[model samples]
Target: MPIPDDLHIQEAATLERKAFAAMESGHLAFRQGKISAMELFLLADKWELAEEALRCLEKTAQSS
Candidate 1:
């Protein structure tokens, strides 16, 4: 496989940061009761943040 250049690495990092932000937003929405379980999961899935989403879900469940 070809090695990624600086620009490619930076772009990937930016995308990951955006995904993390969206996942955090989804968790915030969940805590605020503004979104249902289905909506929260969908939001994470839509943003390609399943791991973060699952982390948020599990954290919430543990808190409750």
Candidate 2:
């Protein structure tokens, strides 16, 4: 069955959100020193997550 265009948009948004959530988790883990740099690289690779957390930080710095 073909998905509707509206549904596709929603799905894409959901996927982007999921990616961002995963990146947020990775950021926290990295900050807490619970995960090493190598582990972070592996986690990001395994999940195919974007650098959403890093982007957020960059935006904050630019605005400030």
- Which lDDT values do the candidates have, in the order given? 0.69, 0.66
Tens digits of per-residue lDDT, candidate 1, 1-64, equal 5433554445555666777888899999999999999999898787766455555545544454
Best by TM-score: 1
The C-alpha TM-scores of every prediction are 0.64, 0.63
Cα lDDT for residue 16, candidate 1: 65
Candidate 2 Cα RMSD (Å): 10.0
Candidate 1, run of 10 with poorest lDDT: 2-11
What residue pairs are clashing in model 2?
none
Q: What local lDDT score does residue 34 receive in model 2, on the 0 to 100 scale?
A: 90
Q: Give the TM-score of candidate 1.
A: 0.64
